[model samples]
Target: MSSETTYAVEFAKTSRAKCKKCSDIIEIGDIKILTTTTGGRFDVTQSFHPKCYTLPRKFAGTVDDFVDETLRDTTEGQILPKERDALVEAIKTSSSATKKSNKAPGSASSADAIIEKIKAMVDDGENEPQTKKAKRDDHYSSNEFVAAYRVYQKEKNDELKDVLKWNRQFVSGTKNYLLVKVLDGHVNGRLARCQLCQGGRLKIDEKNCSIVLCNGQFDEDAQQRIPCTFQCSIEDAPRWKPWFTEEPSEEEKEKMDKLEADATGEGAGDSHGDLASMKKEAASLEWNLSNKEGIRSATEDAIGLLKKYNAKLPEDATKAKQKIGPVILAHKRETPEDIIAALWKEVGKQLSNEEKEQKDKALEKTTKVDANAKLVAAFQELSEYYSKEANQRAVFTYSKCLNAIRGLDYEITAENAMSLSKGKTKVEGIGTAFAQKIKEFCETGTMQKLEEKRADHA
Candidate 1:
């Protein structure tokens, strides 16, 4: 990998831009990281919000390796010391906030506590110079670093005793270690280091060496380990290959060059703004599949784009759906209609199990009520549990039955309801199964199977 000096820079955005990774709007004044690339077919520039920026693969495979290069501080383009600390704190804060939010009801106090924790770290720098220097140099030496890495590698095997408990795994292509051939005292000079603090250096002794991190710190003489707050890890790697002597190509070189955009990639002509508009429109509209004309028209539009874009509906869309991204990817071939239909499907799936059960039970109890009210109740229950065809059937029966009964100016009793369900006189939307349910309800004052469903739900 190329030296770290060629990697990334953090700068405040002067104007609006799109986050290259998420393709979302990055408003003006947001702190963003701009990455530079050169020697490519085009001198491509991509900018990311700090949260979204990952050390690209060409820089270093693992966070450990990235830290090593960062600590080397051999070049100006690399992240500076203070910036590096801020980035590390940002990542830690984000992780901590996520865990806390998942486990408890997040309040302002909880958020304040996290801010204070980070603030405390920042204030620690104000200590006496000697104390600060001791803290700064508090890292592992060559031997202890390697030993910590071995401990990290051993922990992967569950049966191993006296091994560190593994907490997390890095994504593929980002691991720090690979199996490498050893020569002399090094695996191509890829030394181990403090993966957490990124402050120490360690020598590689074994051929199949894995990178390790330790929480142990050292005094100024670097003789003995002392307790350090930094947690240890053998993250981003299990094995590594010997450092290659091959020179990087133009593409690889381009990846190494860290450049920021000369100007924000947003303005009057920006597509992100248009996507935002579409997303807002989609959200403003109510999602209801029972509206046949509305939903069918929307679905038809979506189906057309589905074919054009060759995309499938997302597996889980209820949590938060990004309609505009896909629509934009489709080259704006889609309209808000497609988004509406997609959102409707997501809304349907998101209906709670408890809500569905309640609807089912209530549907049975309401069968002897007003014919129009009973059919509406049935349709609501059907929408929750029945197949698409069944729901459609209920929709049709509700509309047609209500219209016929109202046209006759008759009260919704058993005899009047049966008129719409019997023989050749059947209503246009009344199917066999639905007609049977109506007939049974009219004569017996209840639908038997619906009552059974109510019992099961209860």
Candidate 2:
């Protein structure tokens, strides 16, 4: 693709301007006229300061293909009045050829699709609809999907990291290997490096490839390697490819390298800021019906758990029965804890031994952080198993687990909890009142059983 020597530098428009090729904004001052093949069509022209005009750079698509220097270095006094005609003619000729190529049936529909997608821009205040299109308020939402994706990205990025360094030996009789750099974070294996005095990153240099790691004097750390650290270099370093697997031009490669480098620091050639922002913008990601089906399939397992465990109901149990679904649904609609409570509350005890075993297995998959508390709470709620003292222990356990997870920076969500628990087994849906009640119960922790049982047990 053709490149821009200077950015098109958009200016705020005073009023709209219409041209044959297109109708768009016209600003107060057009400091430079961006050089384009379309000549003065103004419609397709890139408005810029004339001083910035030059031929667009070619983009080949690798990390080292292009570099931007001074305009004077490429084109200076070549700006005689006649020079404009030549540049414009060249642009028109090139653009027309591209148009013709794009129109060819065998050659260009795929290219057009990519071009259109890239060119898509929402007008200010307009939002593009996301796939599933629904947003989570409490964000306990599709915690399952998020969990799945984190795994997916981790696996995906695991395929690309390869930085190695070697250190020189001070004594001629001692050792003779270059230190190659490695990483421990999997994604960021390249952090601080040290000289061979301690641990060293080492790699074998092939005949005539690129050279990022150089043989250097030993003093301090510059890079490290895998054998010493948990994080290791990726066995194979493959080229980065677009989704379509198109090989980028040298210029494109350089662009990518710059962007990646900007995202990573000198010691670490990784980038995360842009990707994070994109994920934040794409937060509306959701799964389709298959996930819902999986949830349904897990119910028999949950039912078994209910059957094995002895059950008890409070004096107000009938009220819970009537309002449980709605309370749970409300909590599911609001907080994560309620979802677990509803799940725990709904299934009645009536299982065969095998059924109970299956339910336990299901709980393993659903064993998420939020669910852990709910499990303990559910256990404690059954006054038979939990003496007043056991109930207090339950509260302490829940608090400790939550604190520990937060300290370790792990997500504590119903879905993840459920996934970790019994094994993805859960009722299809929790209704509004049921979810709400669970949420209210967790928040208040003022259920009567604890107080009454406290006196009975003590």
Candidate 3:
């Protein structure tokens, strides 16, 4: 054994960097290395939990682009060491080039500009890296009116909160205002039917969400509210920022103040209410409960773990079916084709004659529950048996599982890679010059676009 040691490091999404110490996922800047120290034990390199890393990842796009471009400049002799140092200092101190005082030409508003950039990025097509739209509560159902109406019959003139289910849920302070919110499992999917379309008979757009609107006229000098007009700098929310910021009602604010006072002892002044403390607490509490444990009961754990593989279920099934499908596929990809054929043959027996035709391959086996269960059990049992033989065999099984997961996701990318990336089934009109377009292709969409163009000219 040698006292000297070397280590390998990798940068990862905060989601990937789970702190070994606290089991909280590490974020970008607040990342930790899963390192073995002098004692040869695993340790997390983060002093602050995953939450503080949230803010850094907010500017991750800018930071990464700047770092790469800066380093490239250093190599190209376009940037001096002094300039590089200044750039680093600027990044260290999060300086915002606030355009509050001056809006760019052709821009409607600063926030509109951010949204436009996001929209432009999307139009660039399937292959381009995309961030989801900033979520907002864009729609409302009349359920509240019905609920409030029920209560109104009982107490036509009751104080707020006493109005049964109404509880004066309507926001106060700003009259003639619309508070924007993300559709975070809020509102009924059925009530979202477009009132102007199909006489509002359909439940929803199904393809896209509806914009929720709240309209009211207060008796005390009726005022109307519009959409939330606050703007953002990025094309999307900072990964550190929660999906939405809520305007606390006067009552909620008083409650929060009272709780903070109680915790700090009235008049002790919110000394513990520091921003740093708030950041760390937010990160630690996110993974407060383990989905991993809750999943173990009904084969849900297996399905949950598959998410770690980046696999999605395009079909409907039970937890066992979903778990078993991937497990069997893992086994098939690793084992001999003849053995897999044999397994499918056994699986084919339980299916109807019509489905039996589909039973010649691994895909066919998964369509039937008994066959799926049999295949998964077979693989799991094989993995366990292999583990008994040697650590080397166990390693092979683990690799097979991972490989199967990757293979499926890659297949999906390749099939739709070109169209998804470019929104075209074939690439045309672009010449040898455009051929340079694919020096860095990642998804299947990009591949398809190239293959079509390449084949055309080849």
TM-score winner among the candidates?
A: 1
Sorted by lDDT (best first), the order is: 1, 2, 3
The sequence of per-residue lDDT tens digits that candidate 1 reaches over residues 392-446 is 4544445454334333333455555555666766666555666667667767766
Best by lDDT: 1
> What residue runs in model 1 are displaced by over 4 Å at the alpha carbon?
1-7, 12-15, 18-30, 34-47, 52-80, 91-458
Cα lDDT of candidate 2 equals 0.31
Residue 8 displacement in candidate 3 (angstroms):
18
TM-scores for every predicted model = 0.20, 0.16, 0.16
Q: After superposition, how far is residue 389 of candidate 1 from its true place, in Å?
A: 4.7
Q: How many residue pairs clash in each candidate?
A: 13, 81, 17
How does residue 278 of candidate 1 score in lDDT? 39
lDDT for predicted candidate 1 compared with the true structure? 0.39
**Worst lDDT 10-window in candidate 1:** 259-268
Worst 10 residues of 3 by lDDT: 193-202
lDDT string for model 2 (95-153, tens) is 55655665753321122221222123211111334522332221112233233223332
How far is 238's C-alpha from truth in model 3 (Å)?
32
